[model samples]
Target: MTFGWLITRYMYPCFLPMGEWYRTPMDKNGAILKIDLADFQPTQHLDIDPTHHVIVNGLYMPHTVIRHNERLAYCDSMAYRVEIEKNAPIQLQGFTRGLAMTDDTIFIGQSRMRHVLRIPHAFSNCCLDGGIHVYNSTYRISRFVSLPAQQVYQILVLDQDFSLERGGN
Candidate 1:
C-alpha cells in the first residue's frame, strides 16, 4: 500500500492541552512510502520534492494520496492544489483534504485551518470556507457545495448503480 507522509516534528498537536503547543521546526520535505504487506516493511520511498522546500506545516502539506487509472494524485492541503501525474497542479479555492475521482469528474473536500500560527501569504487576504468543490476532466470548477462544518476529512465515490439493498448484503 502507498502512504503519504506529513514529515513534521510535531505529529499530534490536537492531542495537546488547550493552551500548550510545540515550537519545534518541521521537516521541509514531503514523501510517499510504499510498503510490502506480506513482510510489513517499506519497499520504496519517494520524496515529493527535495531540491525545493515543499513541506511547510500549514502551507504545503500533503494530506491525501490516491491511485487513479494507474496514475498518482495527491492534495497539498494548505497550498490549495491537487497534483496529478504528468499534469500541472490544479488550483482550488480552499484547504484541500478529501479527494475522489471518476472518469470525468473530481471531488475535493475543503476545510478551514485549525490553530495555524499565521495564514500563508498566498491566502492571507482570502476567505476560505468549508465546502465540496467538484471539478471537471478539464480541471475546471464544475460545481461547489458549501458545508456548515469546519472540516471535511474524507470523500468516497459510489457507483451509479449502487443501492442500499446491495450494501446491506
Candidate 2:
C-alpha cells in the first residue's frame, strides 16, 4: 500500500473499528510492522531507509537504521534468507526480513530496489550502522557483549506496538 493508504487506514477513522495512526500496527491480517510507519525518533543522527537510501537529519551516522525510518517493497534474498522462531533468541545476522511475519520465524528479505520507499526530509547520506526496535511486555530482544574475564549484563529496550482493532459486525 502507498503512504497515502497508510494515512487513510491508520490516521483516519471509518464507520468500522479502525483507530488512529498512533493506535495501529494493524495485525497479521492487515499491515504489520514492516509496512507500518513508526514515528521518527528525533536524534542527531542520519537514518537509512529500507530502500538502502539515506534518510537524513542534523546529526548523522552511516549504515544505521534511522530511529523512525522504514523499508518497503522488499523481496526475499535466497542467498541471505533467515528465519527466526518466536521466544527464541536471534544472533543478529541482519535486519528482520519484514515486520509482517509473526508465527514460526520472522522472515527478513533483502532490499534490492528503490522507488518502493522514499524520504521526506533528508539531511545527508551516511551508512555505517543500524538499529532495531523492541516492543512492550511479550515482545522484545535482549543483547549483551562478552569480554574476557568480565561479567555480561543484558540490556533491554522498551517499545510499544499498536494496531487497528479487529472486529466483526
Candidate 3:
C-alpha cells in the first residue's frame, strides 16, 4: 500500500469535522499523522490497528471509507482502484465512489464508468474484470459476477438480490 498521495476525509460535512486527512509516517512502527484541514499541516497522530500493515501512501481526494470484517476499504478515485488494508491489496478500478459488503461478496460503485461491481471472495492486491471477482487468501481472482452500467454511485446488497443506485439519478 503505497499511499504517498492518499488522504481521508469525512464524506458528510454537516458537523464541520476537522483533521480528516491523515498521513502515515515512514517510521519503523508506521505512525499516522492527522493533516490539518485548512493548512494540510501535521496536527496529531491517529493510531490505526497494529495488526494490519499499511502498504499504500496517499489516498484519493473525495474518497469513501468502508469497513468490512477486520479490514478498511479505501475507494481511491485518483488511483482508480479500491485498496483494502488488512492482509493484502484488493485492487479495484474505474473510480469507485461507495462500497458495501454482503454475506459473501463486496460490491462497489464506479463513478467514472457508471457501473457497479462485486468481488465474490475479496482479497488484497488483486484485479478482476469489470464484474464480480472472488479471490482466495493467496490473492488470486477466483470468482466473478457481472453488473450493468448506469453511473452507479452506490450498491446495496439486499436479502436476496442486489440493487444499484445512480449518483445523479
Candidate 4:
C-alpha cells in the first residue's frame, strides 16, 4: 500500500495504525459503561440490545482481550448497558460534531465538515476493508439515535477516557 517514493514522504493529515483501542468512557472495572447508537436511518431498524458487549476499535474490553480473539462478536450482558436513542432530527446545517455507537457500529459525524464516518468491526467482518468510510453529508442516514446523556450530564472530551493506549494521538 504505497503511492510511490515521490509522494511517500509527503502527506496530508497522515495517520498511522496502532494495536487499536477506541477512546471511550469506561468503568473503573475496565468495562464499557454505556453505548448508544446514532440512528441515521430512521426508516430502517436494527434489533440490537444495549445490555451487551459491543465492539470498539476491534476490542470490546475485558472479554476481547481475555478470549484471545478479535472476531467481531456481540453478546448480551448485564455488566454493560448498550442503548440506541434518537436525535432531535439531524440538522445538516452548521458544524455539528456528533458521536454515537450501536451494538455493531460506531458513527462519528461532523456536519460542518460535511463528513460522516462509519467504523464497524463486530457489525461487519470485512476487515480487509478496514478503517472508516467517510460519506458526504448529502447522503441520508436517518437511523441515528443518541442517548439522553445531555439531561444527566455534560459531555467533556477532556474528561472522557475512550483510550486504553496513552499518548498515541
For TM-score, the strongest prediction is 1
Q: Lowest summed-lDDT stretch of 10 residues in model 1?
A: 9-18
**Ranking of models by lDDT:** 1, 3, 4, 2
Error of 3 at 128 (Å): 14
Name the better of 2 and 4 by lDDT. Answer: 4
- Candidate 2 per-residue lDDT over residues 1-169, each given as its tens digit: 2121233122210111134422332211121122333553447454433333212211111111111123222211111112222223332332222322332223222232222132112213211122322222144443322224211112223235654458975
lDDT, candidate 1, 49-106, per-residue tens = 3223322233255666676786667787656778787877888767788888888988
Regions of candidate 4 where Cα sits further than 4 Å from its true position: 1-30, 34-59, 62-83, 86-124, 134-169
lDDT of 4: 0.25
Stronger candidate by lDDT (3 vs 4):
3
List the global CA lDDT of all models: 0.60, 0.24, 0.42, 0.25
Instruction: Give the Cα RMSD of candidate 1.
Output: 8.1
lDDT of 3 by residue, 94-161 (tens): 44555566545556655444222322122332232344433343434545455664344455456644
Predicted structure 3, TM vs. truth: 0.41
What's the residue-level lDDT of 130 in candidate 2? 26
Clashing pairs in 1: none
Candidate 4, residues 1-169: lDDT per residue as tens digits? 0011111222111111223323331212223212233433558775633235323322122221111022222111111211122212322222223233343343333221111232222232112111122222345343433443221111122434565576757
The ten-residue window of minimal lDDT in model 4 covers 1-10
